[model samples]
Target: MPSMFGRTTKKLVKEIGDQELRPVKCLVSATKIRRFSLIQRKKARSRFWQLPDVPLDVSLMHILEPGSSVPDAAVEVSADFSDTEVMKQQAAGSVNAGAEAGFSEETAVCRGSSLEYQIVSTPHETWTELQKRKLPDPEPYFLKQCREAGVNLYVVTETVELRNSPVLQDHSSMNISGKFSIPLNIFVKGEGQGGGLKVREKKLTVPKGSVVAYKRKQLVFKEKDWGIHHIAEDDDQETFPAGRVQKALGLGADFKLLQEEVSQKVKAAELSKDMQNIVFSNLLAMLGDREALQDLMDKLEQEPFGHLDGPGGTILTELQKDSCYSGVVSKCLILYLLETLMVLSDIQHVLLAQSMEKRILLPQRDLVRSILEPNFNCSENTPFTLQPELLAPLQGEALAITYGLLDECGLKMELNSPRSTWDPEAKEPLCALYGALSVLSQLAEA
Candidate 1:
């Protein structure tokens, strides 16, 4: 039995040796050994902290120095051992060298083109030194251009009261407020390239209340034109209509036959002989009597013809009373006498003289009113009929008076007469003459 047991054990040992041995079971598992190995690695890693290598030889003073250059140092390190390991070691050595030279891993791998830099310094200079530099003069060029273009610049200093402002249905004349300005330059265009050229520039302030006349953008100075002198003053002086009659009769060169002509015209009219004689005698008396003229002037001075009331207590009184000329004769007769007086050359001379003496400009309507007050005692539309025989002589006489006045004032310029001239400065006298003649013409036609 012992022999058989020994053989059996040997066979079993051989079988066991020939076949794979089975692992023995334990209380601890394979999973537990792996978990313990991982724990040990974590603890070893946490025990020691890794830090970036810094060079001890480099000093802070060397880095802060201006215009200083530092040389880059190279390092080599490798762990791989193979046939291709040399190439890998070479790359690793380059990376380590770049890192030691203060370059990041990304910057070392991805190299870019070299960059260049320039340094600039701050400037130090005073503003006064900069302004002292030479500059071009512009005043000469500006004044030259002004001279070439004949441009004038005037500053208006004052504005005075306006006269003869336009009324409804009246377009012949307009008087704007006086605009005064002192000329800064008087530039006249040269004749024949540069003949008779004068440029005067004076800086002067116009006196207060000095009237200016603006015509077509040109300034009219009173000292240059005598006609405008009347416009520069206020209208306060009274005009004497009888003075016109007295002058006409006293200077009877052409007026000696004026009474005879008027008488002949009145005798041929469709009026009674007595009415003609009455009209004739009253006109003669007005011409001969100086006291009558003085009385009329006193009455005119006391109250303007326009402000007088009629006999019937109303403006439109049928039977005239308390009037200077209305109670003398019929309205037709008064109209005839007015026509006769308005035609006198002496009347024009007297009016012009008075205007100059008083330095006052009278309107044409006022001039007409001085001769004959409107018959407020009649209807507003009442018509006064003069003898048809009298119309021609009256119109001719009015024309003669107008031309005479224009000539006496030295305003007759054939084609460029002051009578035809229109401007704000000359408007005063021009309007007066035009208005008076226009009324007389209308009366003669009526």
Candidate 2:
């Protein structure tokens, strides 16, 4: 291009400078936005919150030295913090440690890996005295478990001093009561621990029994020490229900108001026997001991049985027929009833089936049929009518109670013309008839 206009180029070069004119050619280009570039990382930040705040500087000095073994370490700050006074205490002895020299928002970074800490405490002659012994690295150990199990560890340090300024009067037992204020340092670590991370601490009152065991992801609140009592053998005749059922039953509706008011009232009365048996059965289930079940079965058998009015017959009858109570039985009728009802109740279908065949020595088909059979049914030999012929032999009040119970159980039946088809609407009086007879039998037996 300069060749086409040599005179213009020469004139321009001469006006500017010879040296500048010698390097005239140039190239230019444009680029789109390139936002990111790769670089090596020097420090890494924690992906989650930092560990709880502990006075490691003050406490570690007494137990661990600076040259401790560690690998792959990092630190980050968290929003959690400790009491200002505790910060001061920790800072006093934190000069030589890696701790920050002054008060800052940066808290301890949790070491991610598990740190093995040994127990170092001042020994005492008595176990109670051990409570007073200052523990080394107690906060760290407690905090480590808290983080691993995902819980909170609260530390409270209380000082107890024996004062000798009391007046010794002629009193057998002296009672000194007064209000005094003492400082308490509460350190609440963040929910978790490991790599030294941000720790949150708070100041609060220490309630008795607040501390609990953290095991298998469970937090058990501390319990008072009541004297231990061994569970009595089922045969000992001392088995007692915990009374939850009895409490539930006693709170049931009032029945006397039902007659005139036709209002809501509990149709069923609380059976002391049923509640006791259920509670006993629950306790046995918790034990999960086959031996315990067998023991209960043996105890149940040995228990006396007579008429319903007798001392132990009702309870014995209930227990004897509960398939849950498994053991040797001199009579097969009780076992058969238990095995059949358990299946029908859907409590343990498979287990009951296997038990009936293998343990109780009954055919599976028969047991299943017995369970499926309706509680009340027409005589198989007769047509559809109030089948009083098929009803279990009951007399007087027993018959009345039987009818009432069946009615409550939803077995509505009707006694129609013997020659005509049975209508359920006509069955109400027939039910009343049987109810009277059943009740009479029960009253006589009672």
Candidate 3:
């Protein structure tokens, strides 16, 4: 190193010594692109997004103050705060306990879990009033069983809930039926305190003169000396449901069309029901059980069902695929007839198995109606040919069957002309099929 004349200084100054930004020699080498050292195991604990594990011996919340054994803990924010606004406290344990702040008994819930909120809502702090988050006391599991046993939960006709709700019915009924038109609370027979699934509408038919257990909804009312006032929910507030906010701002006209379009789409999705059938009755009955259904299916796979070079072969293949694809099982004597019906006119493969899922019990007519568009025209005098032997099988089944209209006198169908829609006197292809089923049911009974 050549020094100019006398000497060169050993130190450099003013370089990188500003605002604690001075560079230093590496304890660890500089990372190559993203390939750095692996994350440490313990660093996840300090993250705000991670919920800290509760101590086995203590509560996660500081619910119990230092020396209070009985838990006389009370907390209140400075204002009503446009509903309970949970801003993190800059200073903890700073309570204005001297001023005796007022809040409803429900606010105790808000005070306890507001710190670790599972959910936060604005229109209503709905969960703040709940004691705990769990299934509702009147669960749907038992109700479904009751429905299967020919009992239904019935209540006052005028009760309107915005969504599907399980009205609590009396579980302790001595018989399947209970007294009708009883007060809702009496119908329920027990009072419960909990939260669970929400209610929506389902189809329930209440028979005339039949007994039903009364069902009651969970409702809150504040009974004051002046009157029994209903605590109504202001859910329709803001710019959406009530539309008052939009009207006030003079933008209602602009948004009305958009709102209508949105409403239509939402309603369509909600109302739509999947139209598919699961159980094909004839095969299941013949096989004796679902286990046999599989055994027969395996046998058919191995033996190939006696030279299926015809339409029957195609039907068998489709049936096998359908059975395998769905959680439900279905099968055939009428496969050839189905082929014929299809050849003569347009028909949905209602007899075939579903690729994904099918409704357990879709009537043949419903399956047909699914594909029948509004402008769909029916084929007149649609020729249908059936093996005369099928009639004998239908008669056998109709006799064996004891329930439904098949057993009644004068149940008849004629295949003169078929249409897309049903008429009281018009005959169609389904008439023969149903007529056959009726005969089978009757013969089985005999």
Candidate 4:
């Protein structure tokens, strides 16, 4: 396998103050929370950033015992936290949660003297701790006790990891035998913090209101709930084949007959009229003609930028700066091809990992409906035919690393037949059309 990680390893952030503020077992009603995605404007006026404060429901399932841990008294609060009095007022309410614990309504209702009021609230300086975490639905007895004691349960809205934070390394309690697994950034924006663990240092108390804002914090890493359940099922199961994958998606193809077929279709306008089809056809044309790749590169490099305050400018900048694919024609062509496919397919991310069986697997299948889902004219007999030395890197660890490009997008390629008959719902051929879309993207960085 090629040497891993040529770039300097990114440092984990440490200056974040409220990196730990969060929840354990929490309930998030999807219909209850509002999203702030107005940034992606549907039209001219829709792009306005002046969005009104939206309402969301967040209930905490765990809180520190009256004396279990100290409250935040001196940490810098994250500016992203919404503390408008109006928002709190809209959500504010005192409920005698302990009073409704009994099975009999009469017994609970008559407990007038024993009824105690407790308010719902958020905790500062604590990320949702997933260690020793319970289910989303907290036990009734446990919740009642917390209520009667005037403890407030925090519902985590987001969990940010302060990379390289001294708090994580200095504390052994953060993780033990994988029990307190480092909390992944699972609770997404606008949703209630779901099942997780929130921890406060055993000895130190975090100050209130102080939280980490967007800039100083790292937004890398996330948890997976799909394609992973089968990771442990079979040791010898057929995982994704590296030899075929890189060629089919990352490595450019020898269009040949497929190229001619696509050309004829394009000329006749038999192809879909969508922009995706035009782009995909252009890619097929590139793969077939060596001169086309060079011509495309020339155009991109020669394209003038009036002012790069636009969308494609950043991409052009990144493309020019990337020296990794500089000398290799195939690598350069594959990078652009796969990137265009990602946009056309609307597949923001692809999560593939090495399974226990020494095979590749897709762990997250959400958001991967590539529009180029119908154009793999290649056959099962001819996917690749390169020198073994060239092909060697596309197998084993290097191949795994390449698929990771879909996750981290360092970006590469080859040609191979996709098992069109493979499972359609993310297994096997993953829709040979979608697979060929002409295909893949991956993980965020710290």
Candidate 5:
């Protein structure tokens, strides 16, 4: 009896994590010999066991399913002991001949405890069987058992504590009192048993002008929907949380504050008169806020001239530095801002009473208009060799920015003139610029 206990305990300890349980030894009589059998008492319990203290690593048990044609699987058993004493005990089982030997006595000896297992080598056909049987769904049974066994299931670590909390007492009564539970789903990596699921943080690259759909915590883009979502730079690179656009866009919690702030500012004109004029008149120029827009801008402003400019500033500075597309797009945005200020100035002239006009209104309008339309070419300037390649896309973003500003200023743009190809279809300039920067950043990376 002592030898049997030692062998069984040794075998049980060796088969961990793989959700496997193997029978290696059993009790026997002088007249008949019967080997021990490892049976699954719970429908979906694991066939492997975990022993953090053991050096050989996680173990599993393999057994042939009932009605299968294959030979009984090689029951791979193990134990916690460094020596072979336990293995020797498990192998000393009684014989089973043509007689039902007194079963009550043997049952009593093995009644109070059961072996732990991890499913190591599943039958090849088991997946089909599992589809039908659904026997090893880890969520309810196998994971629960591991939790009972004192393994932190979801968090993978190099070292962990392992314990076999008793399900039944030595006297054969249920011992339900002192057990603890795991907090989350146990995560595993690599192979079978409790070793193939993982929670990892991943980064994916997105291309410019692509329409991404959020679903199941992943960003998805269908081939046909690309051009519908207007992006200014169409080449900007952007990063967001994995899946669900709302989450990736930071639309939750404090991020939702953006809408609130925007609403409050637009609703109440608390700013000084000059600030209000500047905000609305040059709204197209401020297609983005300095502080909040920095999030989208940060990605583009990396390396070389990163310290000098953010995304919006970088676009402006780079256009000035490079001779691409004659800096047409950059010029377009600047010109739009200038024209917008001129229009606002004309409006101020109309609104001014003669007495207040010369003292306050006219000088401020002159200063703003001059600043927006700086005379660069009137002086001696180097002629730039422009590249035609970037003209169209840059032109698109510039136009988008203009449209956004007009909307922000609550002003109507006249598109009837030859120079005015301003598309009314373009929405708010700030939003367009946001989209454009996102697109362009993605393009820059590509």
Candidate 6:
């Protein structure tokens, strides 16, 4: 039974081998195969993948035909061929792109070639040749014509001579000799006056110890005479009073000392005595000297308001005839002191340091605004009204103080509605507001 099974297996294997070796039938026509091969060849010859050096093989074309029996091998070869063509197209595209970019760059560089070359190379030889060329000297004929026209064609040279004078003489003499050279006209071919070559000599003898005096006439105009008159000069000369040297007090001087000095100046026979006294007194009151300031305030409060002369005949009473005088004086005093403190660097430091310990009461915001307001009546000189005469100078002082303080402190505070509270947090800003208001007030007055 085993021998029979072996023989059957051998016969089945031989049959299977015969079936596997059988040939396949072609479905596509020869025309289609020829057309497909022609298309592929045309594509291969196109500009995208041109290969003129390598010719297509007839045998390979024939194998690539559609109706060929070896479909698997043909399909694989066509795939590889398509891949190679795609790779060639990509390489050609990259090469063209690179060439275009390079061409553009080269074109740009060539555009300004002349200018770029000139800038890079030095023209030292050309410059040297230009420097070597000398300008021709002026022609004699031109000079002759200039002299004939009275144009003065001569160069004047001066020489200084130092000589010792006789000791018995009252004065010394300095001899200054000048030489004038008149060039002869070479173009005219002659010399002398007719040829425009002429020389003139001049000598001046200034006598030593000689005194010349002339009476100086005064240019005066009389009411009777319409024209100006030259009258005899008057011997009297008008003299102006000297200004106060506030700097003598020094920036670091004590507040009391400054007050005393200011008081002394105010009491002295000086111009604007009343104004000076009021201004200084107000300044003293503002320096945070509570005891002194309070005493003054109490005295002012005790005085009769309406009458010019009260029981004590106080300064406040004298000023109180004008209702605005008290407020204005106080305001001006504060402004003045603020300015003085700002001007003195040392004093500013002291004030800033002391500000931390003793905070001074600031004037009411409304009162400050009223004084600083532009439209407020400056023309009125009636009782209780601000004197128009004093307004301008007070305003100027205020503005100056404001500027100085702002510059020194470098503080930017709102001026329109300043914080009037005397709290530590508000002190610096309050001071800054005072300055800003002063500036604004001056502007309004202007």
Per-structure clash totals for the candidates: 0, 41, 29, 38, 68, 2
For candidate 3, write residues 139-172 as lDDT tens digits: 3343333223322121111111111121211112
Model 4 spans with C-alpha error above 4 angstroms: 1-166, 170-306, 309-311, 314-393, 403-446
Count residue pairs with overlapping backbones in model 4.
38
- Residue lDDT tens for model 5, 231-326: 121111112112332212222223123234333323332333433333233322333243323322232223332333433454445444634444
Q: By the TM-score metric, which is better: model 2 or model 4? A: 4
Residue 425 shift from truth in candidate 5, angstroms: 2.2
Q: Which residue runs of candidate 2 sit more than 4 Å off their true CA positions?
A: 1-333, 338-384, 388-396, 413-446
**Candidate 6 lDDT over residue span 370-417, tens digit each:** 333332223332223333333233221232233233333322311111
Q: Candidate 1: what lDDT?
A: 0.24
Q: Sum up the clashes in candidate 2.
A: 41
What does the lDDT come to for candidate 3? 0.21
RMSD of each: 57.1, 38.5, 34.0, 27.0, 35.0, 54.6
CA lDDT, every model vs. true structure: 0.24, 0.23, 0.21, 0.24, 0.24, 0.25
Candidate with the larger TM-score of 1 and 2? 1
Q: Give candidate 1 regions above 4 Å deviation.
A: 1-294, 300-401, 415-426, 438-446
lDDT of 2: 0.23
**Which scores greater on TM-score, model 1 or model 3?**
1
lDDT of 3 at 55: 11
lDDT per residue as tens, model 1, 1-446? 01121222223223334222111111121112110011000000010111111112222122121332322121211111111001110111111111122111111111111111111111123212322322223323432332333322111111111121211110111111111121111111111211121222222222221211110111111211111112232111111111221111222222214324434333334333444344333333354233343233223322233232322112112313424443333343344433333323334534433332232223333332322222212223333322233222222223233334544322331211212321222222332343333323222322
Give each model a TM-score. Answer: 0.19, 0.16, 0.15, 0.19, 0.15, 0.16
- Regions more than 4 Å wrong, model 5: 1-243, 247-259, 263-296, 299-306, 309-424, 430-446
Q: How accurate is candidate 4 locally (lDDT)?
A: 0.24
RMSD of 3: 34.0
Cα miss at 60, model 2 (Å)?
39
